[model samples]
Target: MKASKSIVRRTRWPDSAGAPLVTPLQPSVVYASSSPDALDAQYDGTAPGYTYAREGHPNADVLARKIDALEGAEAGLVTGSGMAAVTAVLYGLPGQGDHVLAGNQLYGRSMRMLREELPRMGIATDMADPTDAAAMAAALRPETRLILLEVVSNPTLRVSDIAGIAALARERGILLAVDNTFTTPRGLRPFDHDADIVIHSVTKLLAGHSDATLGYVAARDPEHRKRLYETAVTLGLTPSPFDCWLAERGLQSFELRYDRAEANARALADALADTPGVRRVLYPTRPDHPDHDRAVSLLGDRGGPMVCFEIDGGRAAANALVEAAPDIAFAPTLGDIGTTLSHPASSSHRGLAPETRAALGMTEGVFRVSLGIEDADLLISEFRAAIAAATAG
Candidate 1:
């Protein structure tokens, strides 16, 4: 039996004639070498090679290319963080006098950037309910450059009408960018439904582990790709090579992990729905959910591995439940092999103002469960025990 190929490799250098020259090469040489003139020329966009880590790296390019293929995008760019990808996309095309129509319910940090940072840059923004097609249409202005939305509202688990929003944006001659982090390309490819751009927090599902922090921006057209690449280069938001390698390694088994995690999540959601002291179960797969029909039409039968629910005892009860869970870890992050429980009011949605948080239904009792690869029965039993302990106390 043959061993699997390692993700990392060491390359031999080429001579002045661009041929692999066999000189007394050392085993420590892990990268190819080029002349100063060749390096400068290669780093420039005119050439098709990488010359620096910040501008580009072989591993990062490989990962980005794979993501591009997965998303069916013309090009893709990687960034240090999710917010960096958002910033590069938002700032790349829109100018000072431009306007943007954004979904009212967004990831807290993204909402902050749109409401706080863009305004300071002289870019005007209007928030609209993503589910209401008329409301989204009404928010568009003559100067609106883009419409940004999330496939699934973070923390709240609210699904957005991507096709409707995309239609509205198209009619108004505005670009549509969808944050597909929660509904990754494996489950839901937004580009197929009229989205012009797709952004992802690779830290989550793509990496499938909590080890690396990375983001990606995939564009469907050359112009959009050029703009995003230019902005990424200028902003210096490139991801590290090691992180990119880890992401690539994770992508190899993404399909299997995603399927298993999603199955476990559905089982957990059903169990939670029947548990006492639970106010409401928020899962995209539920037939009675607000956007259930849309989700089905867009994502088909498979829902991603995230579930949000409200506890009967509010913040104190929620905290107690988290503390009582001996197996599941209480953490602010998500998308790992082990289950993670988080409090939105102080974690993912902490950046939102009180009024905004209220509007988005991010109450203290709201808890987000990132289902992992653990056995479905074990996870349910653990949660049942935690709820029992919390309520009894």
Candidate 2:
């Protein structure tokens, strides 16, 4: 039966002491069974009994189930971190001579994983512009089996043609894996567009408190799910039971938090579009955005809580503003509950060469604003004063 999106998020595993108002954390590493048939089911992966923490845990299982329903996936696997999730998929799927086509606009670690780490394992990766369907199509080769892209990329806020890319991938018998961290399942869902896998850094958004460093990869095929699960076990990159429980607890308020953040982001995008030291605003809701049309069709009205822009004087100006900003603090990551800002040049995209970063629109002047549940007018007024003061300094 199809799960209702409204109620599925609120669903949780019933507790031993009967139903509680909220789900409690389960940290047991292993389970013991008295029935021999139940033991057999655990050995064959049929039953729900968790034998070891490395394989699975109750909290992690609950988190995975929620992610599966949220992502509209057949199954979901939770991992220690976002990079772990990415590694599990890349490590499991490709081998010697297999090629992966990835977008150049990925997060620095993800780019490093594909360009540096994956090659170490004998797999080849090609970087391409995910926004360009024709370019991605031309880059596909016989050995190209997986395509990697991020929905609403970080820092520069680039949006891709998911359904178009997925269609092209499907036509070529290739798999398309989308990193849904920036937009989350609330803002956009790749599965609805026929994407093979949806990857997320649950640490950033789903956890909300910036406490849990975890990730999840959702796949609609059972066979692909088996491979991911096996890879996760072998890699020893399983998410902790406490983090999983926290993530599950955080999932309950996702709708409320996401909606408020998106609204705040929309306001900030408009206010920062023509700020004294700002060159341009890159939010999906803005009509002037290059990918605005695509975002509307694929992501609907809410385009996540990220509003990125370029400053007037490049790196120096960005540093001045970021350093002197009073109302905002310098945070390296996004999707947290507090209003925070990050400069990609020194943080997320610092690993990329200057030329490469420029090519991907992630310049030194580029900074991203992750709107929280704070009052929009208050944030706007304070940020405007901060920008003015920074420019003066």
Candidate 3:
């Protein structure tokens, strides 16, 4: 019965009848009812049926079931975008006067939502350094109902203390919601460490392609799952059936894609360490990384697909990489099929003021790379040459 978890996630769903090895996409908006009473029961949650596309679509439902299996969750829900999934959880879990404690370094949009939208709705919000458990604990309040963090933060790739944070949440009766985007189930399942909720941007490594914009929420608590589903419906955040199908198809190759890319990223991180024109290389797998031991403990032997580094000279050298390297690409998003470079200062962290970003360790020269399945040697050669040319006078 023991096999690779990836194989289990892929094979858990039975093949559609008359269609071998493929899942049929159901794009219907409404389903015919056998009787009026049956429809009423379904509407009342006393029967099994889907009434509307916005409420529930077959393709999305199937994908959600698959996600539930993958994340070992009590339930899973899909949304149109990563932020939609996150926002649904935030909105559903908190009441008008509830409190939320979040990590200071999060995706720019996520940070903005907590700081702006939550307060507008009369919810109290607090931010703390995720790497410091004491700081997170100190920031908690009696009214704190939820604690949000990204396991591997945006751009900078700082690994949070998941077990520590989860423990704190348990002791305080607060729900710990972890964004498992950078580190998927393959990298590490946050729920295994007692995370109450796990959020993933399926548009990234789970889909393994840049085409689909999707996200998923996996909750360990059944009540939380029901609340999330209701909130998603109320907000009209359900994904289209077509996008759900594409994301479902993308999941088949995810394990293979994630492992290859993660290995290449670790290789690149190793090769770039202490290279000429390199000031700092931040990858949790590296022995010298501040969170290396924690990552190893939490993630086992797995690593993420992204690596972050800073080259010499300030913004000029960072810009030179784009100007001098024609082969490399500069994309704001991570976890694509191709190796792409991104500058966090101007992209992910631009929402923050200059001083605020620096205080979070996202410097002007910082660049992150989401490594693809390309040959590690070829990428090393290309980046080595580009780094030298960019830093040259």
Candidate 4:
């Protein structure tokens, strides 16, 4: 009548003749272990269940387990913020005198860390165009220990050839770390394309809301996973339990939210392509985009929710348009459900040098839009009105 721990049962009673029942069950706890001497052991270096909240917590573990399932990773680690995730991955692998090769259009803070801070720490780095497979290959050197790239570049919306870069890293015995914040695991899985490590700004698409700030690092190999976990623990980069709980709740409907947001993005991109005062529309699905084919192959039918466009006017005009928008909020952040716009020149990418910004093709007129679940027609009309106002001004 009662069963547990993965068993099958069949029962029949004389009183209920000719009636049969079958049931399958599993144990409540898959595995459990605890050490009696742990009280005396200050730090036994044992995985005898979480000993401290800073090192690990139940909520974080649960979220990590969920991420591991979705990302198909051996293990996952949670961090306080996305930059903390980046820092953990970089510090986990490289030490003094090591080299790192990073994509050109990386998140601005990431670029600052690699180009400015890493050098002071005796770590060398070189930037390369992620879309250029040959350039990525050529950037590797004997001292190169890591290759950092984004699944989908920020601001520009340029999708990289992750498979090609991963293969090159494998050939050189270098670790490939991909920032998959732009394209979450549901939209695209970087590990499936040969990435050794995948990182996400859980504050972004993973949370699907702007309330919680969390980051995650998912490793393809167990060893790498352990190294990341150890680094996070040592650095005290663990996220708070409450934030982890919120992020876990947000992740439940991530796939559904992404679908609606991405669909709205596609419709907005199509509408903006032919609109007046628009110099160019940049979305991964656009035919003219350099990596459109690769994006189609990697992301398939869905391109993603973020879109970047260049207006006919320069920085002033772009700023004017953002100010004139009635519906979309002008903010520095992205990957939110409500429509938000940003001027990368002065916000996200402002930390970079002017020459470096120009080199990455981040022009002054560029404006990025993170589409939400609002009506596509309304978004288009808001943009049309904003553009007209900016041009008239």
Query: Clashing pairs in model 2?
Result: none
- Model 1: worst 10 consecutive residues (lDDT sum): 22-31
Cα lDDT over the full model 1? 0.84
lDDT of 3 by residue, 40-71 (tens): 99999899879888888888878888877878
lDDT of 2 by residue, 1-393 (tens): 986578544345456765767666777676767688988898897876777789888788788889888888766889999999998889887778899999878888999888898888889889888888988988888999799999898767888878779989889989889999998888877888888888999998887878799999977778888898999999899899899988888888888998999999999999998678777899986899999999898887977899998876776778778766766868898878888899888998888889988887888778899888999999898788767766674
On lDDT, the leading prediction is 3
C-alpha RMSD values across all candidates: 6.7, 7.9, 8.3, 8.6
Ranking by TM-score: 3, 2, 1, 4
Q: Which stretches of candidate 2 lie over 4 Å from their true place?
A: 1-17, 35-38
Off by over 4 Å in 4: 1-36, 40-48
Q: How far is 344's C-alpha from truth in model 3 (Å)?
A: 1.2
Write candidate 1's Cα lDDT for 1-393 as tens digits: 898777585433455656534222222212343676666666564556655567777777778888888898866998988888999989997999999888888778898889889999999999998888888888888999999999888877788878788888888889999999989887788889899989999988889889888999988889888889889989898887778878888888888888889999899889989998777888897886788998888888778999988777767887788888967989888888788988889887888777778778877778899998999999999988888777775
- Residue 355, model 3: lDDT of 91
TM-scores for all predictions: 0.90, 0.93, 0.93, 0.88
Clashes of each: 0, 0, 0, 0
Assess each prediction's global lDDT (C-alpha) against the native.
0.84, 0.85, 0.87, 0.83
- Candidate 4 per-residue lDDT, tens place, 144-248, comes to 999999988998988887878888998889999999899888788887888888899898888878888899998777788888889998988978777888888
